[model samples]
Target: LQEYGLVSYHSLNLLKTQALALGLPPADLRSIKARYSFAWNDQGIKYLGITLPGKFEDIVSTNHKKVFAETKSLLLRWRLVRLSWLGRAAAVKMTILPKLLYVFRMLPVPVPKPLLNVVHRDISSYIWNGKRPRIPFKVLSAPLEDEGLKFPQILAYHKAAAIASLSESLLIHQPLWTYIQSIALPGHSFPGLLFTPSKSRPPLPTALQITRWSQNVMTNTYSPGPMPHNTVGGS
Candidate 1:
């Protein structure tokens, strides 16, 4: 076992025997002896579980059950987090290559500089440039699935699907949708003012349309004239 680097009782015995046979110096022997003592270190707490003269069981009272419970709870929590990460990473690895192909397909065939810039900027701003890196799949789904809070690192497969679908098919209506927002305004206007984009626009408004009009232009107006004056019994 020692020859193959397996840690086992047989390997330890073989190494010890060979060291003794070589007539290793006293200092080396002491180092070798130290290594044989089985110990466990947690944070800074060291326990010579087997080799020390007294074990923790002998010094610490076993009746303090709460400490053991806390330790177990902490250990279980750590394991749960570790296992969750492992599972998520494994799933990501399996889907990443295929999903990336879809995202690339979503990319415009003859990508324009400005449009690419917009896509890159939106993807970077909403998806990439944050502390958490978005998984490609997750980036696709986020706006659709309505996942409010997002972590940069982990993205789900369904989300990538959403992004892919949006890229391939959903974005087709973007131009028409935007055209509608630009031409229409919402609700009845006040006596002096024009329409605001809410009531008249589509079910939604584009960021651009809102940006084109100033807030003052969108404000509601009261009646332009005051009540008619009474001209001393009738004019």
Candidate 2:
């Protein structure tokens, strides 16, 4: 109450409405306070300083834009002075990759392919002194011993990151998976969802995108004995 100097009248009204939506009476002090929250702006609302959005996919896409912007800034630094081919490769692998890894590890949502291409362009321009790449990207991205530089294809990292999220609960089979199962997946099991092929409509963008990516990672990495742990359905 305003008399107690705890909260403003406007905050109290917002809390009251939110509490009512949860089927709690506004008069209940516990419910009122618990429902209390503040928005940073009209476009964003932060709870405890965390910006959770209406759609799950927005979180990933928004963060990726930020990563891209920061990477772009870094890339501009080298626009005037191009690094050696080896030096540029190292920067891409080391400096740029980690910026991506931070968000990729945190959220496994689909990243737009074009955004990755933008990063690739920056790296390529820096490497060749603003000239186009002479070698095919596939050849240039090969391992060091294969008479080519070892540049990590960002998409592969995206797929692996997505696979890591889907395989998280499957690998452990923890109680937390109960929450995942409850989320709009009705009759589908996560194992069948990932391992079993389906033509049915995808449940969520995260689910669909991650499944497609997992398939790609599995197909690309399939070999004798190397896939001992990740194998499913004998393939």
Candidate 3:
């Protein structure tokens, strides 16, 4: 158009002339299709107020919908199954665990205990027919040789996933991790090594912001007792 703020798009000969006619800055008239190369991007992929393809350190998910919805759908449908105890265990192993892992692939944080407990309640109902199990849950969690179903523990799994995600940035020395460390933990190093900044040296605002944001994400993901809070409002 003749006058517009900024609309990023692929380059063509006419568009360049139009941009010049509009008196837009030369720097503003350009394309990134080749640079980005992101397919199936109709909306250009936005996250955390920044446009994609953003930094690895900026990718933080605050809530989960896909995982919760899939798990809930499976749990609800599982009610109609008329099966024995061990048979029910097989059903869970086949139907539920796979869905859980599917969601866990995208979910980088540990799900809250209260939310996970509700799912576990649905799982408990499916397994024991809404009756208190003869064996304790801790015992029920044991391996087959120890005479247990080796049931999936949601909280444990979530925490493990979170730890694994943290390790991506903290332990593994990938290119993304290296870039993140330079910004996030500039002074700090592994094995408890950190150099103090001098009067001339100072922490960067942008780096500190990203670092704190990442830390907050990990902080929010904590494992707790298997009890859904009473104030959990859902019908």
Candidate 4:
């Protein structure tokens, strides 16, 4: 078949020989290749905006820095314009929050506490025009009906996004990602495995770590008592 393919093999020489036998030109084959190496300095190549085979923490940290930088630039520019408190809040919701929410949804990882604090501080400064705040952040985060500004709570929103991702994986039957994630979770049903305690569960792959962490967080937050183990059998 004359189709694009990805080959993973132990021996590069063996792979090259097979490719030649299959009529794949050396130049065409060499043009696209990624080999894991202990001495490699570069991060994995980007495919569809994700850094393949890179550490999940590194990806999250990179995106976090980007989002913070972009938001800070926007806030500085907006400060030049005269806007009411309400208008500032609207600007943040429309522009800044969407960028953050996108990252939260895409990665679904537990954001570092220090990173979250930094974002919260910068966003607070922007909202208050770098002056002492007249209203508390918690009140600002409340809905309009409750006499508040409906400000985005970064930590809450991040947790919600992680929970949403977990829900999507659980509710969707045999999702493509589940198959890949399941490779690390042999013989365990995804739904039941979610209920298994962190100590009892095996070390999860990077992609599923946030989902598992979010599950535990939700259980702790909402459950009246300790959650029972409910691990189901079969892969």
Compose the digit string of candidate 2's lDDT tens values, residues 30-86. Answer: 554555552213233444323445455577555778777888788778666656777
Per-residue CA lDDT of model 3 for 1-235, tens digit only, reads 2223335453434333311112235454335433333343422354433333223332332235445666677767766878887687678778887666645544444355677887777777778866777667788788889987688887777655644544454454554644655655466552121111122234445534533333434344543335563211111
Regions of model 3 farther than 4 Å from truth: 1-63, 169-175, 190-235
lDDT of 4: 0.68
lDDT of 1 by residue, 85-189 (tens): 335334333543233334333321122235334333333333232335545544443453575323222223323332333232224345453344335535522
Please report the candidate that would top lDDT against the real structure: 4
In terms of lDDT, the poorest run of 10 residues in model 4 is: 14-23
RMSD of each: 30.1, 7.8, 12.4, 8.6
Q: Is candidate 3 or candidate 4 better by TM-score?
A: 4
Task: Assess every candidate by TM-score.
Answer: 0.15, 0.63, 0.53, 0.70
Segments in model 2 whose C-alpha atoms lie over 4 Å from true places: 1-51, 80-82, 173-178, 182-188, 199-235
All candidates in order of TM-score, best leading: 4, 2, 3, 1
Summed over model 4, clashes come to 0
Off by over 4 Å in 4: 1-42, 47-53, 196-208, 224-235
Clashes of 3: 0
For model 3, where is the 10-residue window of minimal lDDT? 190-199
